[model samples]
Target: MTRRICISGASSGIGARIAVDLAREGHHLTLLARRQNLLDEVAEQARAAGATSVTPLAVDLTVPEQVRPVLEQAGRFDVVVAAAGANAALAADAQTHLKGMAWAAWHWEANFRANVLSAVTLLEGLRELDALAEGASIVLLSSIAAYRGSGSGSYGGSKAALHPYAYDLAAALGPQGIRVNVVAPGYIAETNFFQGQMSEQRHETLVGQTLIGRAGMPDDVSETVRWLTSAGARHVTGQIIQVNGGASLGH
Candidate 1:
């Protein structure tokens, strides 16, 4: 059934693809991002794809005050996808390991704020709608890196924390008819996520690790997200569904 959905990071990448896909399926949407121009462009694409109604709210989710008013105005939604994220590369040219510690710390702190705090804040806001709606589903965008701590340090740790949060949320809200789950994705192409820092060799290594033998697309991740929020996945909750093309299988 068509329902109202709110998606953060909807201006691009997997989130944008999800918005367009769901709109084609006739869902009304609220697309949130920090870039107004980009959000408007995405909304237009969703409209062209047959969205029932597409609203764009551009706000920096890192700031609570900015996030509050936009969420309050958006009102109730059947599904909420928290997908906003940022990435910082650890300086690999350090003369000594200790020299890079400060840089890593800064990057880790920023990643935690963006990935963990943002999702938690949004979940808190959704509590306001709990009494008004029969139920709601939340899909948190995590990373395959969450399964095991990686070189990204804080970025991986932030995502790892989301697993427990999702599990606890599902258990706590199950009686209230709410479901929470996580989508841990592997390598998705055509996003500004890596900022083109990945080398051709690095890309090949990532693809080689995946059983699919190639990098994934935005649609690959979005399709799983769409299904997870649907009644078809009603029985599934508190699980971390990996969309990693068979990479990092054991974890």
Candidate 2:
């Protein structure tokens, strides 16, 4: 069944991979990101991969006015993947720690704005679309950090907040013939997520915890997201599908 889908963060990483994979599955796509060039490139790739319709939208999602219009223009999709995100690690030293208070605050607010609030806003926009079909699905891109409070302060907290929000969204929309779920991924490679801050030792330690003996790939998360949006998962709303290669012992 071919369906129209809208994806955020489609310029790179897991979102980009998902866009391509969905296109290959015969889905139509509306790709949104901050970079016009990158979004266009990804849309081109999606078209080549078999997307029935490919539209690239460039906007800074953190800005409400910018995001709102683009999302409204995107119309309705059978599935919406909210995958845009940003992260930063607060320095551990004392001076840096004090300085990081302000930094963390800004980052925390931004994370909530980008990772959590943006999804909610987009969902609102979707609801306004008369073109939305019944039984539509929404997949929120959360993180395994959402399970605990140990990682970067703001990042972990913002992600953890998403779990409850996703559940609430699912419960609210399920009765309306809409399904909402969260895909929590851990340590995916090839993403600017870490911003080159993770050390080799830290990377190895993360991989060692995974049952698969390697860090997850963008495709790993993307595939699970695809499944959750498919008809096979019609009965699977309000769930957090973790794709961490067994990291954090199923957290």
Candidate 3:
């Protein structure tokens, strides 16, 4: 049957791919992101991919007030994919002389806001607006860095915070037949995450770490998410599903 789904970060990368994948199943979708132009492009792709309906909403997840009005008008959702996140440490090297320890602290704060709080604010608004349907599925995008650490300490630290939060939310929402889970990915290539900063050596190193001997594509994560939100994964909740291809084995 067709379901009503909401996906944040739907402008590009895994989020856009997920929206299109689900759209092929003819589901109704609400796509959210900060880029209006990109969101519109994704919406067209979703429609072409076979989505029964599509609504694109441009809003910054960092601001709670902006999200409230959107949630208030978007109606209820049966599935929510919190795919918005960033690695703020990429910009840290430019400000290395910002006093004692401030640089490190800034990295932590920026990542927390981008990764953790962005999802929190959206989910919180959904709860307050009573916009989640019964038996809804919620998936938060995380990284294997949460376990093995990333170039930026704050990136991994921020993602790690989601594990316990998912567990707690699973318990709290179980009574209402709502499920919450996480997907931790590693070294997914072609994503905007690296921001064109990935080098050949680093790319080779990450692929080598994977037993599968290949870099992950957007489909690697999106397909996993598709299953998690489907009826096949009805019994799965509060678990961290890793899509790292054995890269986190050392963890």
Query: What's the lDDT for candidate 2?
Result: 0.81
Clashing pairs in 2: none
What is the per-residue lDDT of model 2 for residues 1-251, given as tens digits with 9 covering 90 to 100? 89989898899999999999999988889998888999999999999999999999998776777877787778777888889876634323213343556866766776677677767666766676554567889898888787765455677788778788888878877777889889989889898777667799999998998998999999998889988998889899888888888887654
By TM-score, how accurate is candidate 3?
0.96
Best by lDDT: 3
**lDDT of candidates 1 onward, in order:** 0.84, 0.81, 0.91
Residue 82 in candidate 1 has what lDDT?
Answer: 90
Evaluate residue 2 in candidate 3 and report its C-alpha lDDT on the 0 to 100 scale: 94
Ranking by lDDT: 3, 1, 2
**Leading candidate by TM-score:** 3
TM-scores for every predicted model: 0.92, 0.91, 0.96
Q: Decide which is better by lDDT, 1 or 3.
A: 3
Candidate 3 C-alpha lDDT tens digits along 100-185: 58978877888898899899999989999889899999999999989978866889999999999899989989999999999999
Per-residue accuracy of model 1 over 99-191 as CA lDDT, tens digit each: 467767767777788789888777776675452245788899999888766676788888888889999988888887888999999989888
Give the range of the ten consecutive residues with the poorest summed lDDT in model 3. 91-100
